[model samples]
Target chain A: MEDVLKIGGKEIKSRFFVGTGKFPDKAVVRDVLEASAAEVVTVAVRRVDPDSSDENILDHIPERCVLMTNTSGARDAAEAVRIARLAKAAGCGDWIKIEVINDNKYLLPDNKETIKAIEILAEEGFTVLPYMNPDLVDARRMVDAGAAAVMPLGSPIGSNRGFRTEEIVRIMVDEIKVPVIVDAGIGAPSEAARCMEIGADAVLVNTALSAAADPVKMAEAFSKAVEAGRSAYLAGIPERIEEASASSPLTGFLR
Target chain B: MTLKINGKEEILEKEMTLTGLIKDKGLNGRNIVIECNLEIVPRQTWGKVDVKDGDSIEIISFTGGG
Candidate 1:
C-alpha cells in the first residue's frame, strides 16, 4: 500500500473519504464504502425517531469503518461544538467535521466560526476537521486552532463544479501543516484525481457518488482515480518547456 | 408529568427514570446521546438518573450527511 493518511493517531489506508448523504437507498452506503475501500465515512447528526425502531445510519456502516460526524445544520460555533459533543456521546468517535454555515443561499461555510469551533472541539479531545472556503489565511488559522485536518471547498457544497478554486487550494496544499482534504464541489472522478495530482491529502465526496447512475462503480472509479493521482504526484511530472526540442538531432541523422 | 423532549412537550403518566423515558420513547439509548437540563447524561447513568417534571431533554442521533 502507498502512504496512508494518518489522523488522530489512526492510519487510513484509503485517502478517499465518502459521505453518507443523498443516497436513494441508505443500505447502499455500506456497499459504496466497501467498493471505494474508504476507511472514514462522514455522517450528520439529527433527531432520531423516538417511536420508530427503523435502522439508523449506524446500522448500515461497517464496524471497521471510522465514523466522522459533521455539524451540517449548525449556524455558529456554539452549535457546532454542541453537535460535536453529542456525536461523541453517541459513540460516533471523536472525529468531528466542523461546518458552520449561516447563509443558506450559497451554503458557504464561515471560516471565522469554523476556527472557533475547531479550537473548542480540539480542546475537548475531538479530532477537528474544519470545512472552509479555500482561503490560505483561514487554512493557517484552522491549523493553528488545533485542527486535525483542514477541509477546503472546491466550489460550493453539492455544486459539482469541480475545482473552482484550484489555485487557492494548491496554496493550502503547499503551505498548511496538517492534511488539506478537499471537501466539496467535485463533480467527477477526474476532478478527484486532479486534486490528488495537486497533492491533496484526501477528498470527501457525496453528491457525485449519490447522483451517479451506478454508485458502486463510480466509487470504484473514484478509488482508482485517487490512487492514480497520488501515484502521479509521487512520480513528479516534468516541467513544460516553451520551445519544442527535437529528440533526434539533424546533424546526427544520416542525410 | 410534562417533559420537554427535543423542545416538544410530552406528557407522561408520571415522573420516570431517564432510561424509562428513553424506553417509553422507543429509543434503546445505545446509538443516541441524551442531554438533561443542559447536562449530558451518560449512557451508563441513564438508568440511575430520573426525569423530573419540566425537564428539558435533548436527544441526538447520527444521520446521513456530508
Candidate 2:
C-alpha cells in the first residue's frame, strides 16, 4: 500500500506469489493465474522426470512473470546450497527461495540450517529470499546473513490457515527494512489482502489456489482481494469505537 | 532397490505412482518438489506419475520462516 514492495530490484505489484503446483493442469494453471494477475510465480526444481520431457509445465507459464526457484528438498545448509547452485546451473539462480526443513511432521525450518544456507548462498552472490519464522530475532539474523528479503510465513507452509502469528508479522514489518513478504498458510484472498493491509510487502499463495475446485477463478479472486486490501490500506479505514465518545467535559470544566 | 527417501528405504510392493510414492515416503500432501532419477516430476501428474524400482526420488518441502 505504501508503495508495493520491491525485492532485489524486482517490482512486485501483487503481493501474492502463486506456486505453480497442485493445479489440475498447466492450461488450468494459466487460466487461474490470469485471473489472479499475480506478478510472481514460484517454481521448484526436482528431478526432470526420468520418463518424459514432452510436456513441461515450466515451459508454459507467461514469460513476463518472475519465476522463483526454491530449495524445497534441501535438508540442511549444505543440501540447500547444493540445490541453490543446481537452480543456478538450471538457469534460475537470479531468484532463489530458500526452504530448509528438518522436522518431518510439521515440516518446520531448521533455523540453524536456514541461517547457514542464507549466509552461504549470499556469499555465492545469489539473491536469497529465505522463507523463515516470524521471530524477530531470526528474521533479523536472516536479513543480516544476506537475505535480500524476508519471506516470513504467517503459519506453517501449506496450512491454509490464517495469520497465526499476526503479532510477529507486525513486529517484523515494524523492524525490517527489506520487503516482508508474508508466505504460507494464507487460506483465502482476504487472508492475502489482510497481510498486505497489515504492512506486509507481499504474500505468497500456493496450496489454497492449487487445491481449489477452480484455480484460475480462485486466482482472480485472490488477485482482486489482494488489490482491494492494498487499496483499503492505502485509503486508511475508519476507526472503530463501539461506545460513543463523551461530548460533555466532566473534568475539563473544573479547570 | 537402492532408493532412499529422507534417508530410509522400503521395498516397493508395486511400480511407483507419483501419488503412492509420495504418500509412501510420508510426504503425502506437502509443498514438495519431486525429482525422480534426476528428472523433475511435472506438477500435474504428481498424482499419476510413476516411479520404477531402483529409481531415485527426491522431495523438498517448505518450512516456516526466512
Candidate 3:
C-alpha cells in the first residue's frame, strides 16, 4: 500500500509542504520546490504594486503542486473571506490557508476569527486549512466548521523557535479527525522530525528553508526528516521509563 | 475620471472599461484579480464592465508568504 496523505479528496504523496517566502531570490523557489518534493505550497495574496513589474509567484510554481493561497494580511474573518475570494478569482485553486492575525506583537492567530472564516469559506466550497494556536477546543471547532486540516503553530511565524506546542499538538493528532499539520516556528529539520514522531500528518515549512544558508539543500534535508519521522511513527516508538534497562542482559556479559 | 486603485487615487484621462484600464496600466497578461467597490469583477466580464468615476478598484496577485 502506498503511504499517501489525503486532504480535501486529494491524495498527496509527500507529507512535506513548503511556503514561497523569504527566499533570497524568486528563481530559487522553483529549485526549492523540486528539492522538497512538496505537493502543497503556500502563497499570500497582496495588491500589485503599480510601480514595479515583478515576476508573478505562480509562474515559478509547477502545475503539479497545489497552490494554497493564504490570507496572511487579513486581520479578521471578513477580510480573510475577501482575500480568499480574490485568490480564487485569480484562477488559483480553491485551496486556502486561513491566517487571520489581528495581534501584530506576537502575530498569533485569533481562534474566534479563524473559526468564523473557516465556517464561511468552507461553506463556499474552499478547502479550508486554518493556522492556529494549539488549543484543542479551537481545533475541534475548526473541524466542525469544515476545516480540511488543523495547522497548529509549532512556535511563532518566522521565529524558528521550533516545536513549542508539542504536547498539545500530539493531543490534537490523537483527537482530531482531520490531518494535523504543524506550521510555522520550525527552525530545523530535527523539529520537523519531532512533529512527525508525535503523529502529525504533515508540516509546512518556510523560513527554515528560505532563511537557511543553502535553501535548496535545506529543503532536501527537511524532506528527508519528515519522511524519517513519519516512518518512525509508523514503526512505533518504544515507551519511555524512569528506570534504566540494559540493552545487553546481565547474564549475557562476557566473563 | 478619477479612480481609487490599490488604495491610491489616480486620474484617468477618459472613461474606459475595466479591461481597457488594465491594458492602459500595462497590467494585462498577468494573473490578477480585480475587485470594484469590494465586489469581485470576474475576468470574463472585464471587457463588458465599464469603470465609473470614484470606483475603488483593487487589483491583487499572489506573492511569497507562509
Candidate 4:
C-alpha cells in the first residue's frame, strides 16, 4: 500500500513538515529541507526591508516543496485573512496556515479566530491549515470550516517543551476527520515518534531542527523518526498493560 | 507624491507607476507582493497602476517562520 498524505488534492510523500525559521544561517535551510525530505514547508510573509538587499527565502526553498505561508503576526481573523491574501498574491501558493495568535505571553493560538480565518480562506479556494490549541471542539469546527488539516500544538510555540498534550492530541487523531498535524513544542525526534505512534497524520518541526547543534543531522533524525513512528502505527502498537507481561512467556522458560 | 512604504514615509520627486517605484527603490525582479491601499495589486498590473499620494504600499516577501 502507498503510504502518502493527501491534502487538498496534493500528495505529500513525506510526513515531516519543516519550518524555515531561526536558522543561524539562512543557507542552512536548503540543507535541512534536503535532509528532512519535507514535502511541506512553512514560511512567513513580512514586509521587504527597503534599506537592505537580502536574498529572498523563496530562492532557498526547492520548487518541489509546497510552500505553506503562515499568518504568524495576525492577532485576529481579519488580519489573518489579509496576510493570507497577500501571501497568495505574492505567488507563493494558495496554501495558508491560519495561525491567529493574540496571546503573546504564552503564544497560544486563538481557536475562535483561527476558525474564522479558515472559513474565509478555505472559501476563497485556498488550502487552509489551522494551527490551534489542542481542543476537540475547535478541531471539529476547523474541519467543518473546510480546513484541509487541523494542526494542534503539542506545547507552546518554539518552547521546545516536547509533546505535552498527548492525550488530547490522541483523542483528536481519533476524532478529527482531517489530518491531525502535531505542530510546535516538539523538542526531539522521540516526541515526533510519540505523536505518530498515537496516530497523528504528521508533525511540523522547526525549533528542534534550527536550535539543534547540528540542524541537518537533526533533520535526518526527525525524518527517520517520523517514518518509524508511522510504520509503528500502521503495524499496530500493542495495547499497554498495567501489570508486567513477560515477552518470553512463563511456560516456555523450562518451567 | 508621498507614500507610506512598509510603514515608512517616503517622498517621491514625481508621480510614478508601481513598477517605477519598485524600480526606484531597487525592489524589481524579486519575488515580492505589492499591496496598495490595503488591496493587493497583482504584479501584472504594477506597470499600469499609478501610485498616488498617501498610498499605503506594502512590499512583502517570504521569510522564515513556523
Candidate 5:
C-alpha cells in the first residue's frame, strides 16, 4: 500500500524532511535533495546585500519541494512572528517552522515562546510547525494553537546523539493528534528507522547526512531506512517476550 | 545624505526609493524582504517609500539552514 503524508492540506509523497545546512557546497545540496526525494526542506533567513548578485539559496531549491522557512535566530514569540512575516513577504511560502530558542548553552527550544509564535502565525493562515521540547502539555498546547505539526527533538540540535529522548518522543507520537516529526540529533539511519517504527509521522535529518563521507549516498540510505521502518510498522511486528518461545514446535520434528 | 544599510554607511547622492536602493545593490527584489527603520517595507511600497538621511535599512534573503 502506498501511503501519502499530508501536511497543511497538501499531499507529500516522502516522509523524510531534509535540511539544507552544513553541506560542503550548493551542488551537494541539489544532489542530496534529488537523492533523498524529500518533499519538504527547511531554510533560514538572514541579511543580504541587494546590489550583490550573489547566487541565492532560493535558486538552489527545486520548485517541486516545499520550502519550510525556519525562525532559527528568534529568541521570543515577537521575533519569530516578525521572521515569519518576512519569510512570507519574501515569497518563500506559507510554511513556517517556528524555532524559538532562549537557551544559548544547549540551544534548547523554548516551548512557551514556540507556542506563542504558532498561535500568531496560525491566525495569519501560515502552516506552523513548532520545534519543541518533548513535553506532553506543550505538544497539546501547540496542537490547540493551530500548529500543523509537532516536531519534538530527539536530542540537542546537531549533537549526533541518537534517540536520547526516545521515551518522551514516543509519548508525543502516541498522544499527539497531528504528525510527530522527530527532529535534531539523529546521527544514523537506524535511529531514524527506529523513530518510524514507533509510529512517528516523519524524521528531519541534516547533520547525519551532511556530515557523512558521501552525503548523497547517506541521503539514499536514510530514505530507504525510513521506508523500511514504515513498512515494518504497517506490517505489525511481534511483541517481545522475556522467556524463549520456539518458532518451531518442541515435539513435532522427527518424533 | 547618508544611510546605514545592512550596518554599513553609504553616502546617498539624492533621495533614493527603497526599490532604487534594492536595485542599486544588484538584487532583483524577488525572494527577499526589506525592512526600513524596524518596520517591514512591503514589496509594493518599495517604489513609493523613499530612504531618508540616516535611514537604517535591512535586506534579508533565504539561506540554507535547519
Candidate 6:
C-alpha cells in the first residue's frame, strides 16, 4: 500500500485514511489508529477549539499518523482558501482535504465552487486534494488546474453505499495522472477492499469506524481489507467473461 | 470552578448548559454531538442540560464530513 498512494508530494503507507472523530475516547481512537495502521488521518480544523481548552482531538491521535486537515465547513472557494490559510497558520500541515460542500444535508461538493477553490489553493502552493464525484472530465480539469490528487467518492459521504459507480472510478483511474483516492460512503471493510482492488490509490473512512461498537477492531478490519484488496489487485485478478471467449474476432476461423 | 471536558479544565463564570456552551464556543451544533458524563445530550435537552464541576464531558464532531 505504501507504493500505491502518493499525495501532496509525499507517499502514504496505507490506502485507508481514518478519521479521529466519533471514537468513544482518545484511548479508543489511539487503539483504532494502531489497529487500522492508517498512515494519513483526516482531521477537521473547526472542531478543535484551541482557546476553549474543552475540545481538542490532538491528544487522541498518536504521534505517528500524518494529519490531513479539512475545509469541511467552507461554503465556497474564498472560504475554502481562507480555511486553508488558517490551517497553515494553525500549524495543521500543508496537505488539505478541500471539501467544498455548499448544501448541508447531502454534503455534496458543488462542482463550480469546488473547482474555483481548487484553483486558488493550488496557486497558493497548497497540496490540494479536492473531493469530487465520479466525473472524469471534471477530474481532468482538476488535474490541469494543479490539484495534487482527485478524490472521487465511491458513494455518498458516510452512506457506506460502496462503489456503486465502479466503472466510472475505473475510468478515473485510467484517465487521471495523479492519484485516484476513493472517498466517502464506505460502510464495510469489503467495500474498502473493493475500492483498492479497483485501483484507487487510497480511501477515506469516518462514519463506519466512528459509529461502530468497536472502532479499533473495525479500523484494523479496514486496514487488513485494504491491504488484501491491494495485494489481490497487484497479484492480478482473473479475467471476467459473460461466457467463454472462443477466439472469435482475432482468430476468426482458426477452428 | 474548573470544568473537566475531554480531560481538560476550563473556568467559567456560571453553570453552563450544552446549548450555551456550544453558542459561546461558536461551534456548529448540527455537525457535532455532545456527551456529558457519558450520557448523550438529546437535542431537546441541549439547551437545558447543565454542566457542573468535575464533569467528564466529551464532544465528538464529524470531520471527514457529510
TM-score each candidate.
0.95, 0.74, 0.98, 0.97, 0.95, 0.74
Best by DockQ: 4
- Supply DockQ values for each candidate: 0.82, 0.06, 0.88, 0.90, 0.81, 0.08
**Where does candidate 6 stray beyond 4 Å?**
A1-4, A47-53, A243-255, B1-66
Candidate 6 achieves a global lDDT of 0.77
Would you list the clashing residue pairs of candidate 4? none
Instruction: Choose the strongest candidate by TM-score.
Output: 3
lDDT of 3 by residue, A47-70 (tens): 888678677888889889999999
Over 4 Å off in model 3, which ranges?
none
- Where in model 5 is the C-alpha error above 4 Å? A49-54
C-alpha RMSD (angstroms) for model 3? 1.0
| Model 2 DockQ, alpha carbons vs. true complex | 0.06
- For model 6, residues B1-66, the per-residue Cα lDDT tens digits are 578765677787887788888777776564455667756566678887888877777655533332
Residues A20-105 of candidate 2 have per-residue lDDT tens digits of: 86665666766766777777878776543333322455555677777778888789998888777666654543788899887888
Better of 5 and 6 by DockQ: 5
lDDT of each: 0.89, 0.75, 0.94, 0.93, 0.90, 0.77
Q: Which is the better candidate, 4 or 5, if ranked by DockQ?
A: 4
Q: How accurate is candidate 2 locally (lDDT)?
A: 0.75
**Candidate 1 or 6, higher DockQ?**
1
Question: lDDT score of model 3?
Answer: 0.94
Rank candidates, lDDT, best first. 3, 4, 5, 1, 6, 2
Please state the CAPRI-style docking class of candidate 2.
Answer: incorrect
Q: Kindly report, for each predicted structure in the order presented, the TM-score of its chain A compared with the true chain A.
A: 0.95, 0.90, 0.98, 0.97, 0.96, 0.89
Where in model 1 is the C-alpha error above 4 Å?
A: A51-54, A243-255
Tens digits of lDDT, candidate 2, B1-66: 456554446576677677877666544343456666666566577877776666667764332111
Name the lDDT value of residue B45 in candidate 6: 84
